[model samples]
Target: MQEAKTILTKFNSPTRFEYIVRQASLESAEAILNLNLGGVYVDYEPRRFHVAGKQLARGVLGGVTVDNLGSSGLELQYEQELKGVVGIQRVELSADGSTIPTEAETIRKAVHGSDLILTIDRALQSQVELELSKTIQEAQAKGGIVIIQKPSTGEILAMASMVTTETGEIVSTSHNRAVTFSYEPASVLKAMTFASVINEGLGVGTSKRDIPDTVILEWENNEGNTETEIWRDEYEYETQEMSIEGILTHSSNTGTIVWAQELGQQKLYDYLRKFGFGQASGLEFPYESQGILHDLNKWDPSNLNTIALGHGISVTPIQLVSAYSAIANDGIFVAPRLVSHIVDPSGNMERLASTPSREVIAASTAHQVADLLTSVVENGTGEKASVNGYKIAAKTGTSWKYFAPEDSYEMPNGQRDPYLDINGQRHYTSTVTGFFPAQKPELSMVVIIDDPAPIEEQFYASHVAAPLFGEIAAWSLRHYQISPFKEVQLSDNNQQAFNGQTIQEGGE
Candidate 1:
């Protein structure tokens, strides 16, 4: 028995042989023992834990069993390739249920699973998670998402999603808000509007509009009755002549509406589609939302103003970031990818095909829009996102949450009474998106804080999200050893000046 155990161990087979003696006939048991001692059988097992563990980008969960692959995230996305084929064996069994090894019939070897190499940088991913967790706690936000991507390659480097529990403890979630949650993008869409205006031969310098604090529209309802709707800016600005760059810098809703009106509804819709709004990002993420962009037939006078100001439309964080990547990539739109390639068991690699791309806007138009965004980071709403020595191109967004009628009002049951805040409750989604080394961007990122508290100086994107962006951007640059484009002077007030020159606006 000791010699048999030693032989089985040498053959990499199970060492226990008492079960065979109990279950098999005397002759079969002798045959099994002889086969084991001869070192003729071997078992190759598969792994249960593959890659980084649970909720790695919101994957489904199942028990750790050999047959149970992960249910969500990349696990589900590439399950076919990850789950290798099972091997099969056929043998003549004795009446006692033990195999007669000398009469073994046939066997088919297993094919090992292919390995997936993601574009994610594990170290950078950890850093992003740490910073995002801290920011969500400091702002007392309900949830948040941060995404870092390479503009030239459309490879997602890091994705972090964190949410606050009912107990007020912050934790990472499996919801993957960056690719799933859709909401009004607010002023972030203004950059797309400005880009469209520049692409149609309507020079940014030549395009000027007189904007009012409020716009009143009268239209006929479906019942043929006259309806009146009022659209107002967040704050009252003087009715003055403003250029496209000024509109983006100040984040003026009225200014954007005026330009959208001139650009026409169909043209604006086409440009928005081209920018990848209201569409899936093609990353093949499970349950990924395409967001909401009403068809042209659904358009009304209110939609014109609301959509222009990013009210009526909804967009996911991935979709928004991909569109910005196009601008950063000099107007070429490349679909974003998560998995870089797969390595088969044969030690050969199968690289994923390059995602299709097209020129959405002229390179010059993209550069002009990028320059306008630079002004925003330098002297406008995104000032908090500015790094010390990098020419950052960025935009800030603040949008109100939409409450459904059923949620706003209580039912006839013993529930809370229906009520609406006269000034609208102070709930906001604050966001900052940008690309650094503005002239030739390497990294583009977006940070979103959902429903931050109305605490003093904490509700706006500039105050909440922009600071987080600056921290992550600065750290990434230094970690990646990116050289600064210009000398920077940091004052005690935390303000940064670049080589004694503020980035000048287009048409200067």
Candidate 2:
């Protein structure tokens, strides 16, 4: 009776109410019948208001009663939100079992939630993804990744992956290779080794250990192979009397291993772990792998040599880049961050900022490391990474491997064949990691190109990853207003050159 009174007084009497009911009935009936013209009879029958569509009306409006009505959109996802009540039953049955509705509906309770606001610039992310995809595809490599982070705050500006599935579908895998996959990092570890020496007050600038610019890595004979593994010649060509700076400038494996030896296994492993090598960076990922760092007690004579050169150790790119960021941040190590904040529809903001960076070393020591790394890009293997008008500090790495159950540097016939093949020619995964505006750093990035085709065309990091670093850094520098490093005469050319202002130089 109350339902009848309410329908008569509030829903049917008013012209607008009648119109709304008519429209809803028509739409609902047609939807059920899947036809507009055939559903008029359905609306004509005088049916009792049936919340569960189980009861007939006592009488029709003007001798006509609509049988059904339904809601849409928001009412679809949460019908209870719109004061929709469960269909009640008043009668037992018609030919088909049915029930009449009699209840006042109430809306469902509202649910509270939150949203996230990220610091990643859309344009910058797009640039990095596009460039990284192009490079990896052109290389016909398995897959690759690039990550750019601000050195000061450890804010990740851009990250992209060109990961391919086992099914041959090239896609972005859920795994963040930059932070997850940890592998033996050939010569890239040299930076930390060099930094550890400087921090220990070794005074690399004036060490009097008769440090040869080149050292023949002396190893024992192979267990299976007939090849005798004696001390080979120096890995790279450089004067024996060159300074420690000269070792890193040229990315000398033997030179770096020799220096790390000075630090010794115990101290070197300590510094490596201190630099965030053997643990996760605590990023928001489930698959982050803690890289392998053998305890000093576990080190054999060979491991000491190889780990010194970054072969016996394993590390993720994030660890590697974060370690580099320590140098860029003047000895402070900031945790790498992704999401900057979260916001709701009401514009309520919940900001998520990186934790305060911890001081890993003295600022002076960091500066010393930066000074040497700067030379690496200016006149060394990373020369290809130099930006025209910016201070670029970089290191290039090409790791060699032999086909075996475990990693071994026993190159076939005393050659470091680090190249793989794609399409027809040989390829390699060349990596270049560094930061820009080296004097007052802003951005740091790592470019990794895996097993690129056209090896002769684009094999080394200088040819593959360095150029990419230059492009990304130059764009980022201009966008961020980072002051460029002025080209100064760090070395006399075959003839001569000038520093910024003075022309006083000699070489000829």
Q: In lDDT terms, which candidate is top?
A: 1
Measured with C-alpha atoms, the lDDT of residue 158 in candidate 2 is 73
lDDT of 2: 0.64
lDDT (tens digit, per residue) of candidate 1 on 357-468: 8788999998898899999999899999989978899999998877665555444573543232234354789988888778878889999999999898678999999999
Off by over 4 Å in 2: 1-108, 164-170, 205-239, 344-346, 401-427, 485-508
Top TM-score prediction, candidate number: 1
Model 2, 1-508: lDDT tens digits are: 8756765575445453242244256567677446433212233332223231221110100011233221321112122222323333234433332323445344553333333344556678767766776776766667777788887888777766666567765665433566666666777778888888889887664453344444444444446433222222235344465577887887766566666777777778878888887787755444567888877777766676677677768788878788888889998898877667756545677777665577777888888778788899998988888888666888888754223323323355654333322212343567788877777777888888766664565767778788888888888777766565544445446234443333332111
Q: Where does candidate 2 clash, by residue pair?
A: 47-57, 48-56, 48-57, 54-99, 117-341, 391-485, 420-427
RMSD in Å for all candidates:
9.7, 15.6
Model 2 alpha-carbon miss at residue 109, Å: 2.4
CA displacement after TM-score superposition, residue 5 of candidate 2 (Å): 52
